[model samples]
Target chain A: MAKQYEFRIKGLPYLLVLPQMVIVFIFFFWPSAQAIWQSFFLQDPFGGQYIFVGLENYRVLFTDESSAYAQSFWVSVVFAVSVTVLAMSLSLFLAVQANKKIRAASFYKTMMIWPYAVATLIAGVLWLFMFNPNVGVVAWFLKHKLGYEWQYLLNTGQALTLLILAASWRQMSYNFVFFLAGLQSVPADFIEAAAIDGAGPARRFWKIIFPILSPTSFYLLVMNLVYGFFETFPIVHQVTAGGPGKSTAILVYKVWRDGVVNLDLGSSSAQSVILMLMVIGLTVVQFRFIERRVNY
Target chain B: MKRFSLLMLALLLCASTVFAQIQIDWWHAMTGKNAAALEELTKRFNDSQTAYKVVPVYKGSYSDTMNAGIAAFRAKQAPHIIQVYEVGTATMMNAGGAVYPAYKLMKDAGEKFDPKAYIPTITGYYSTSKGEMLSLPFNSSTAVMYYNKDAFRKAGLDPEKPPVTWPEFFETAKKLKASGMEGGFSTNWISWIQLENFSAWHNQSFGTKNNGFDGLDTKLVFNTPLTLKHLQTIYDLSKDKTFIYGGRENKANPLFTSGTVGMHFESIGGYGNFKNTCKFDFGVARLPYYSDVKDAPQNTIIGGASLWVFNGKPKEDYKGVAKFFTFLSQPESQAYWHQTTGYLPITVAAYELTKKQGFYDTNPGPEVAIKQLLNKAPTGNSRGIRFGNFNIIREIEDQTWEDILAGKISVKDGLDKMVNDGNAELRKFERLYKK
Candidate 1:
């Protein structure tokens, strides 16, 4: 048995971590608390006047089906889930291939990882140019080469598809780096032993390699979900601007539009408070259920 | 030696007092050529004065500037003068103690400011119901139709005579589409051109309480039979490919510039850009009206930004601001800005000066804006509409309008949804101010 070590100086441990705690408290907890406090009141833009009305803002936010909030909720759901699953799976597949014995391995890996260096807003704008209906190269090819009508500006489904594709394409690079690292860290002896035991390649990957990568997979899953929830706002903003009848209006986009653009603070704050709760619940669920299956 | 040094320091302090000029902060959202025009005006003002120096700072886009100004005000570091867009007028007005009304400022400074000296239609949008000027009008524009004269000629229609009625306009559009054009006429600002200005031009109220001018208890009334008819007609035309939906908010401008479409509706301020970019001949015409409406084609409302002064500045600053406004209202400066920037001249004297200089004859495109705005005295609806959250309301307008064209919602339902959502925003604005 190894020696078990414990810190008897409780004050020293708290003192050592005090700086990070202060940073998180000031940056995260303070603003979240303010958002929750502001959600119950109808406020002006400059906070010149605020009238308290308990739960009225939250009620109005969820009640307006015709106001496009319902559609936005559904869009946010589909957007987050699809982007997380598609980006993770696709990057993982590419990472596995890039991990194999192949020619010019670093070149393929570098090419795959280059998109991570591009800003999310820049990525969105580049995709927008490529998919522009009138003069874009992709649009022209789709119409002239494939003989298909690609009208994203007015088509609801097409707008969402383009938004998801742009967001997923941008997200895949980040996922690829982690997945490649995780694949490379898997020991070589397990694979050779499984191969010697007469197991096929599919069986080895599913039973051994996949189980070993669960820690990285779980971390990526949590990260991708949180990112899908909040960080895609700029891409949605520059690309579609929550148009084509609120089809691409994600929840965070609505928060910015209402709070920042329209100055509807109460509704915006209520939406953000809901988003805060959602993130908290997601983190709890992921750590409680998913972490149990993740191998150390 | 100490006595000699003290005497020298006293002399230096006296010299510093004589050279110091009061610097007033002026935040604006003008970019590119517009910023250059504003800089020239500032240079002229600074050169003519010794006691005050005006400092103009570019603060990003209109929305960014407005938000920055508001945030600054909250921090008690607000600029002396902030240029706010027309849509931001309502929010600025409701800022209450944060704003120093232009009329009050002029009176306090004892400047010789006449409310009647300014164009009624131009100032009407920025004035109270009692005709009190809230913010000084700096740059103003109105909607006008720009048609490809070459496309009209190819369609066997008279280039000199553009369509005056809605029926005639659609007929001409169909003809142009048949004449080998890619699509029919598209519009730049669909909500402003189709709904807001549409109701005003037809002498129909956009909302109760004089389009939110009389009181804060106003709700939108734009879903009437006539407006519904117009929305439905546009929807049908879009389905038939006679009216191309070229995205929203001036994204369709290239359609007109590239000669992909026949006619386009855009702000009169776009004249300079269109002149530089268009490869074909274009003519400016008044927006088409429905013949059946009784008092159709009322004057168009202004669409550009205005200069607003914030409160809590020193009294000396207000006096300098008044002097600046006095200089800005001069006919020469107004005409120079008007001719250079393509925004309308706010004062009648400047208009006359530009006309006397034969500016209209050389540039025929801008004459249509003045003519359309002076068609008749503005009624309650035609004056202007002011409501809170108008920016997002415009987004809602664009989205719902596209939804109608996409067949997701009927025209009637879409129009109703717009009115419903718009009224909800208005109610929120009312609550914010009424408190």
Candidate 2:
């Protein structure tokens, strides 16, 4: 600033932001530090004793001959990219339709946003019921009507597709809300001018509207990627349980399975650390490259 | 002044009574009907004594409860008693100073307990290599065959006779499938029923060192010719949809109860749910085994949970725990528990008591699990498996089996993968516990 305006008291600014700092430090930093510290040690499930064996956990993870760790990484990547693209594109389509001045547009918008109210686990269960090979209605239709045996329990591709659809279904509403807000912010005069210049609806959307929505789309891309990576555990757990053969066991789900179910503390903690680094790296890249393309 | 003094004396008497009774916390994972039954039993134990009061707290699922108990132990606020599932037996046993062995708890408290009173197959699972019981067997169950008798009659097979051998079972499944049944046979807990209990029931070694009883340096030996033969048979059956792969762990129960699947393999613990849900007549039979093996159909291994006493509680609380265990061990209480929950009566006296009372005559399927357990003296291979990282091992087995069923891998390859992955987990557990 041209003129420096300082706090009257030495510690006043620190005091003013003390509550948020305390919350962030206690909830986020503390647990992350604990994970980093625990990643270096081998501990029993009871935590009665621990021995520091530096880098062994990480080494085991990277060098695992079964390639389960590496497989889960690729699974996570495929899952995240598929869910983000499907969810964002579908929601954008719906948002564009809802942004029209048609009758009952508000009603359409309200109905489209209803899925956001469902908890992730509940959404997963709902999809699971619909896709259950034994008694699922849709499965029954596919089998009886189409003469196709719908068996996701044994088909890796089918299971992955179900997970992608369920995960995207739950996230679509959130993206729709943001996309609708973004569409509303685009000045109508721009579209009108493009229309007067003899541009068709599709051409007007591509040339005038979509460029202005780049900032919102970029923001959603990052958010959707993170959600797909970390927040799809419930979907995978309830629907496929990372099976027919670990086909859907993403990195985050593996971390939970090892750490919580198997009680392999060091290995799971190492996984957590690696996942944290990957996300950090991803976000940095997104801001560096993708943000440059945003018109805002 | 006289009335005030009388009131004070009454208050003092009440306070003294409350202070004299030791309170013991019992953390359990029983839910729904079983939970209510547990609450009733706890109330009975409390009312039957003036020296102690045991409060039963509902923890989440079995694994969640075990984790919570471990966390509480680390915090030095552990409950006096915890109900740990059978898979967690090795973990609890290796927890060294964190637990007081059940036999020692009883002996130290000067309570009279006879390990011989319990069914040998039931107690053998939770006992040390030296045959010392480490945890009190509670709600024990074993895998068995469940059949829809109505489906059998509809398919023109004898409703009373279930297949006693694997070859016969497969033939019957083919017959049922030919009769237009959608799913002829299915199984829950494929790894438990098809692998662990399958090996034990066939008198085949599941692992070296008597299934990891002697030491932690155990390797899975279930990839034997017999196991491969059986898996290959199942694979062949699956090609025609005669054998449906029900998802893991009791998920197949609904298929059987809904009468969609003709025959099902599940735990005896599923008896209550089937009896209540199935519209058709559901029957229980012993698990099928290969007749070619000389020592085929040995006793099956037990599942379900046991009561483990934790260390680091007051002496008085230990005394209360011993008393609670004594009450649970009584024949009447064990029989009641068995009758109500469809779990096995752990003790011989309870089994005999229930039989004498003609409970088995009226409820025919409840006794099948008991008979399966007491059918023969358990050999080294048939007793039970005690291995580190068994939960993870079970997961790996499930994955491999699914892969095999899905045609992603051959049966031999799947079994080999299971063994290799299981051994690696065992090694990791060995290293961790060595600390």
Candidate 3:
């Protein structure tokens, strides 16, 4: 009952994928392999020489007596989870509002998507300007009108909160686009039938629209986690610099600070490998468990 | 058409000839106004010579520039020269076969270089224990106290006489606060000013082995009774809102310049920024010391960048580098740079030249930094600190200090943690460099 067709060209498939394969190997796999190799060795800053010290770097990181490594891991988890939840919920809410048959909906959608075009670092700088304790307009208002001394510079909790808000603010636009698309694709007739059956807006959204959007939501959850974990470095760097006493020093920020600023290539590489494993483990769990509930 | 083609060919040939000249690339981390000043100096060097053209490239911040330089060196495309920050000195020095020491390069190139010509506190920082200069000191500054003269006058303190001792400083801060100033005192570079320079300024050892100058096996010893007393003073000050913890590393500069904080401790290099920004007159003074400590008020350490020559460059490029350094060393050029940038004059001759030109008479603040550098002969501890992995050690210090300030840990516990964490980093660095 099966029909097979062959072009009789042995190298065509390979030829067709050669460019992408070459790019992926050169850009991704090669560097990752190099990181794995470098993680096993202690190297000078200038790369003049290297000594293979087999797992010493990992041992030092895990056995750190100061608990900096462990604390950064927890900080990363809190940051990534908070950013994902905050960004996703906010974007979903905005998408739902924009999906309604309201006047100037297209204009609202376009304006909402404008933040996606701004660079991440610029977004961070903008937020910094607004929240800076000394010179920020919002800080001035909080100090003068609201009678609240907003000192993120000294308060670790406040600094972390500011970073989360800034990071999630930048990510909202990206999640909104996906969520809006997902909401649009949900058949309107289902909602109409539910309305006819006396279902309220909240009930319809909870029972019908949310399940229909599960696939997109799951996809976005994974993406937002990765973004929060790895790609929020610029925001941290530009805003808090993982400071106010290392309270905001996330895992990825530590990797950069150690590798680039401190020039400890071995430790940085080991941390990168650890982060890679974490992401792999997370993605596997998501696909195995969360994907089961994602309808289609 | 034939004549037009010939003219175009002539222009192309001329352009190629210009490009053929050895281009000495100098990667630096200067940005904004400083970048423009650096570019002007480079243009002067280029116009002054036809044999070599020194091209300056703006390469992000200090750490970013160092990373880029390291990556480029690995790719075997390193620049001829790089501007390394003061903290990166040890790393650059230990980068075997990757750099040509400034003294050796100058000597081998037969340049008329005199190590003694530079200010001792300035050159001693980038030198070996034997006083051999490892890198050419370009822009150097020492920590000093910056006071708002208007605020001091308003607080009924002598505007001309800044507090010279810790007790006096605290009293003045209280007075400023009593005078209704929002912030009485703050500081930038807490670790650098409070601990490192504080130890050096009191002639107390910050670490063993001459502040890590002699070898890589140095351990941090700044967690002493003296440092504890100073930190306790700051802690008490913070309790009363007299001393505002203005984040870290020049973040407090705005508090001083905005006239909110009456007194601020910052690098003398902040002169230009303060002069440009502060609406009220600001005065520079030597960093305060504990009055009870004998031999207190030793020379403070330098805290700016230097020009390092990398290896694996053409011999001609080395010669160009030597020539450029010679040009920079000229008294006129050094004085000009000092006047413009507010960085200390590297050479004694430059200082004398600047004084002879009556620059200090009109601009009184810069002389304080220069005088602070030349205050006394640098003792063992007063000489700059040079330890491997100092960058990480600095982070540890900052974190510990923050913890102490935030009341998360006791002063002794925080300082003890700093020593432990810093020693571990040093051990790691020693292992890496041992081979």
Candidate 4:
């Protein structure tokens, strides 16, 4: 009778969460574990054979002089971090501006979010045409209006600029939505009190508004960084193709290339495991060092 | 009461089984006009046969179809037949028991499946050394040059005569650009047409052992000076704006058809689209070559895709597939397909049948691709690439071209990188087979 009581008390939470737990284990956690397991093996694309090589794939990924693996990994980090910061900052600025009782603020807010409605694939296609060397409107402006002999598609720096712009454009809208919601929830009495203390717009923003928006910024940064690596794949593949000599080859694209394009599941899995480790290590570092600086 | 209920259920099952038709589902990547043609063909086959019903479903693109098939196979829910692109041959061949060879399927169905019936150059590429035909040929095509006759005439060049060699082609391209054409010369499938097909047409090995046909241990051999020089030619043209670099693959076709480009080198499948579009006068010709090489020009290889039957299909359904293939290979059907679409006739008899019907005379550019392909038997290099992971190799080539076009890397350096990286992919594929 005592054991039954213990079992009933202990197993109640597990019983309640069983269905969700099973789904998470089967679909998410299982694939991740298998990916880690596959990282230790080498797979042949043609014959579908697997050979255990004990971190050889990782070794190739980390230290290979000629492979694009290391380059893509570093690029992904830079891309993710830069896009996250830029998007968060821009969204915060726009959200603060729109929070006021200015005329037509709703109209401005609505227009800012229009880019989020466009699918990444469709956006990529539109960007390709917009950057076309011969017929693109941007090309015409660069050559004729600005008198600059510039092409965006083939230039690495310009290509990256466009990619970040497109990525940040969508992300800024999402961040704006979140930050606006967070800003609205910040209790209007606090903002009114700060303004009564002879604080300027800049001071109020830095002292009161921004401090409260820190949590929202942190959340948006994490989500945007993850999207930059994973969700950005369709746009990158469709537009740049990691071209101009692999200037924009990100980590997740490398995983997709290795797995789907090359059919080397082992190498792809190794890339995935490495990417996971990198994201985790990065998150931990940020929490340890940067979280302390948060005003909240 | 329970026994009676179970007996009734069994009887109901038996009754339904008596009149039920064996359904075969096919997944293909053909869309637009070609999709319509395929639907018509399948509908005709379904009407002709009562034993089995063949259903054709349009999957998105070539890569999408291949990925879907791979995922389905992993889930044990694959369709009966899948139309795999030419580049995916290696992946499909390496699938082992997941696929059923057409030879085996036909034999099991007590149907006559002859490898000799197909064009040697086309069939040999997809067949094993044992001469087993693994897949049935569907929409076979080859690369050809599409020229804007109006642009040529405006440039003071003959609208009827196309350049025969690389030097002549380049010279004409310069002339076309000098004539103040907005876009001079562009190409689709830059990697496929320029690198892969360039190597084939020049009889140069893209990889060792005739592009990995002999074994998986094949290495990339596309870094030779000849290949580098050819790549440099295009790269130099891009720098000069004489050659307009379009998107990576299949992205330049619309530009050509829309009259933005004076000349375009693309797969012959563009015939239907170009015919429909292109308000300007246009002509098609054989792909140009480098005159310096010995026996420089050769018949170009096929593009498009093939229909591969899967393992899980029934014997009766295989009979239906065979019958459909035979019907597809008929002279009238082949002529209609060739005349209407840009794909080449797969069978020699159908080709001759098309010629006898004077379809070529009525439509000038339609016959140019077939004539280019059948002009000579494909040699070792010109036949086709059979290496595993070839699609990735093409991806590497695409990036290399981008690098060259962007002036980020020298032509020689780009080709060297392509060879090195492509060889790594080949080695990876080879290890799979050896194991």
TM-score of each: 0.94, 0.96, 0.96, 0.91
Better of 1 and 3 by TM-score: 3
Which parts of model 1 have CA positions greater than 4 angstroms off? Answer: A1-22, A285-295, B1-19
| 2 versus 3: better lDDT goes to | 2
lDDT of 1 by residue, B269-364 (tens): 999999999999999999999989999978788788999999998899889898898999999999999999899999989989999999999798
Ranking by lDDT: 2, 3, 1, 4
**Which model, 2 or 4, shows the larger TM-score?**
2
Docking class of 4: acceptable
C-alpha lDDT of residue B274 in model 2: 86
lDDT of 3 at B230: 88
Residues B316-427 of candidate 3: C-alpha lDDT, one tens digit per residue = 7788899999998989888988888888889999999999999998788888888887788999999899988888889888877787887899888888888888998888
Index of the highest-lDDT prediction: 2
Pairs clashing in candidate 1?
none
Winner on lDDT (3 vs 4): 3
- List fnat per candidate, in order: 0.64, 0.64, 0.65, 0.47
Predicted candidate 2 versus true structure: per-residue lDDT over A1-296, tens digit per residue:
49987887999999989999999999989989989999999888888669899999899888976648888988999999999999999999999999988999989999999999999999999998888887678987998899987899999999999999999998999999999999999998998988999999999999978988888888899899999999999998899899988889999999999988888889899999998898899789788967587645
DockQ winner between candidates 1 and 2: 2
Which lDDT tens digits does candidate 4 get at residues B1-435? 999999999999986774576777899998888888888877877788676678898878887787788778777788888999988897788778878887777777677656666677677667775668788878888889999999999999999899999899999989888898756789888767887788888888887877777777888887888877877787778867788776777777766876666888988888878877789889999999989898778777777888887776566667777776667767677767776666887777778888888877867775788777766788778788887778888888887778778877788888888888888878876776685
CAPRI category for model 3: medium
lDDT of 1 at B401: 91
List model 3 lDDT by residue over A1-296, tens digit each.
Answer: 79976758988988989999999999989989989999999999888779999998899889965647988999989999999999999999999999999999999999989988889999889998898886677877987799997888868888889999999988999999999999989898999999999999999999999989988898889999999999999999988888877889999999999899988899899999999898889789788967687656
The true-versus-predicted C-alpha distance at residue B292 of model 1, in Å, is 2.6
In model 2, which regions exceed 4 Å deviation? A1-6, A285-295, B1-19
